[model samples]
Target: MIGKVPKPGKSFGGCIEYNVLKKDAAVLYADGVRIDKVAHTIDDFNMQRKMNPSLGQAVGHIALSWSPNDKGKLDDEKMVEIAKEYLQKMKIQDTQVLMVRHKDKEHPHLHIVYNRVNNQGKTITDKFQHYNNLKFSKQLTLKYGMYMAKGKEQVNRPQLKGIDKLKYELHDTIKAAIKKVNNITELKKELAKQGIDTYFKFRSGTSEIQGISFGKGKYKFKGSEIDRSLSYSKITQAIQQNVQQRESEQVQHKQFVSDLKAAVQSQTSAFPQRQSTGGKSLLEVLLTPEYIEPMPYIYDTDERKKKRKKAKSDL
Candidate 1:
């Protein structure tokens, strides 16, 4: 089971869409999460309007898709119970739940629509922490004994696989490289000898970044694709253990340039300064404020000092 929390784009009208996949059919929602007893199609839109005169044109939506493992044997009652449990666990009491049976696929699933802002006028923030969600789903699956995928690994949830086993070595390799290398170029050189590629891309947060890549037989070791916080030494060891294609010189050059540019840009942006161009001065522009009068300064000369001394002696 995988859950994705993505905000709907303008195409979906700026509404937030929450979706999950289990197996079989996909559910879609527009407004309150429930579908009426009389499942109405687009052709029956006009009839639905007459039957329930106050039905709004726009309805909030929630959707769910199914996986092959579900095998068309899903418990509707259990699904409802789980949905309610999740909401309650999140401490959402006022939210309404709507379930719609979708005819879209072979497997059975329902669409659940919920109002983020409830009748009590309290707002429910849609903050989906991915790590926490994964943890919760794992616990829920174990508790319910829902149809769990048998062989698949490295999903949103934690299931060990062949790749995960090798990840341990890769972790060490990446760390080793980071420790010894001065710049990206040197890092790429070290990784190339061991058969890994380096890539630099922007990650979600300003401080976060997608790290290097490595080649393993037919597969590539993308730091982002592999694991979170996977460092240079870790990737190197993984590549060494897997024994993939050695890093090419061309890849190294590209990595070198990328690292150099990022370093330069980072240093440049760190410091700020005002520049003076060859332009007119304040006198030339004559824009100085006239209301603020300039102060006058007096300089004492030798003659003035001598006269003051003579007057002082006479007195």
Candidate 2:
């Protein structure tokens, strides 16, 4: 499951209109709102917003999306249930919320329209709403055995827009670059060639890189934020592993060449009459060892020890 918390809006009129009046939109659930008509719902949200007239952004909107793989398992009722649990986990309580499911895309998704001015007229803070949305949505995804997407490959690139599109572009570019380069410096150079910039967050007063971010055009996102596997340490570890693997392969190749030369020398020199197994070359037989299962081990039992002890007593 994926969740997006759009920037808060000043009014619910446009937000409610889009979610409610869309062609494929269906209002699955409503709380603390008049469900009789669209205007009534808008008025209900406005009346609640009046409680906290000082707050500018009283419209809180969130979009929850699931992969196409989960289309079968999710129904309107089940989605509303999960959405409520998600809202509860996100601390969006004491607020008026309207959940509407839309069948516009291949995936099952819903839009949650909520009042920032909650039931008691208190402002619902959105300080960590983005982080919380990500954290809680994932928690619910696993908690309910929802279809877990393996990676970004399952994402529909064409359907992505705005900040999401930029983030995924960075993810794909960085991943492709990492495969060709073996270190951070080379990674930065490669990304630079592609018009991408890499920024490192240093540990306080130290040269150590604690975090990393990538930028393209006007947008930037933390490497870890792009995906956990793209973190600073993760990327560094990947470079080191690639370097070690290449070196190991080179050493193995050199050893194999040396062994083949030695075999050829033996065939021409002292051991010219090389032995063969089923007409195979000496080197071929040496390179491919036949598998032989070893005999099972047997341990001397305590009963055998006792019998030996009894025989010793006879002596």
Candidate 3:
């Protein structure tokens, strides 16, 4: 299941009509208003909004969509129960709301319209509502055992309209480009090939890049707006880690080459030189160790024998 919470608008009648009067649409449930007619419902919502005239754009809208695989699992009553539970979890109490189920697509989905101006004339807080919407959607999907989408990869990009399409386009382009580049500069250059312009948001009076935004045509979005993983800090960390890994490999390769060269030089220096001695090469002398006579063996053996005999005779 997925939830999209668009920014509230100022038209209650138009929103209600679009949800209720659209083709194949049915109002499953409505609270805090008369449901016999759309005008009466709009009038009742606006009557409360009149109490807080200072607030503009007093409409809150949420769309809940289930995967087509879970179509048969949900019925009108169960869906209404889930919607009411969702609204309660979202802290949208004391507000006029209408839930309409639409059969315009293959999936089971519903649209929620509520008055941001509650019955007590207090403005319902919308701060971090987008983030909250995502959180509550996942929670309810899991609690209800609905099909969970795998991520943006399974999204039907062609079916998305307006900013949603642009967001996915940027996400796909930037994510693919990040894998092939080495740094932010190369990243920007690569994205530019796809007509995406990268702009850095720098801190005041400093050179630090505090954020990043991507623009294609007239639409521009902060990196975090597209997806959390595409944020400037996350991208920078991934790039730096990649760079360090490459540098480490290069250093290891250079060290291996230096060690091999040193080993070759040492082997060449340790090799024995062949020198000619008295017209005989050192190799020949070494090979003929037995043939070379010592100084004592060079003397006459006869003279030594005669001297040994004389000594024996005297004895």
Candidate 1 lDDT by residue in tens digits, 235-260: 44554543332446557767876776
Residue 173 in candidate 3, Cα distance off native in Å: 1.5
Task: Show where candidate 3 strays beyond 4 Å.
Answer: 192-225, 231-315
> Per-residue lDDT tens digits of candidate 3, residues 230-313?
899999888888788888999997897677666656665675654435676443454464655335545489998998999999
Scanning candidate 2 in windows of ten residues, the lowest lDDT window is 268-277
List the global CA lDDT of all models: 0.48, 0.88, 0.86
TM-score each candidate: 0.39, 0.75, 0.66
After the best TM-score superposition of candidate 1, give how far the Cα of residue 83 lies from its true spot, in angstroms: 2.0
lDDT of 2 by residue, 1-315 (tens): 999887899879999999999997899999999978999999999999999899999999999999888888899989999999999988899899999999998889999999999999999899877667778888999998888878888888887777777788889989988878978999999999999999999999999889999988876778888888899999999888888998999999889978897877676555545344577665555566682335786657987898899999999
Q: Tell me the lDDT of candidate 3.
A: 0.86
Best by TM-score: 2
The clash count for each model shown is 35, 0, 0
Rank list by lDDT: 2, 3, 1
TM-score of 3: 0.66
TM-score of 1: 0.39
- Which stretches of candidate 1 lie above 4 Å from their native place? 8-62, 90-92, 129-131, 150-237, 243-315
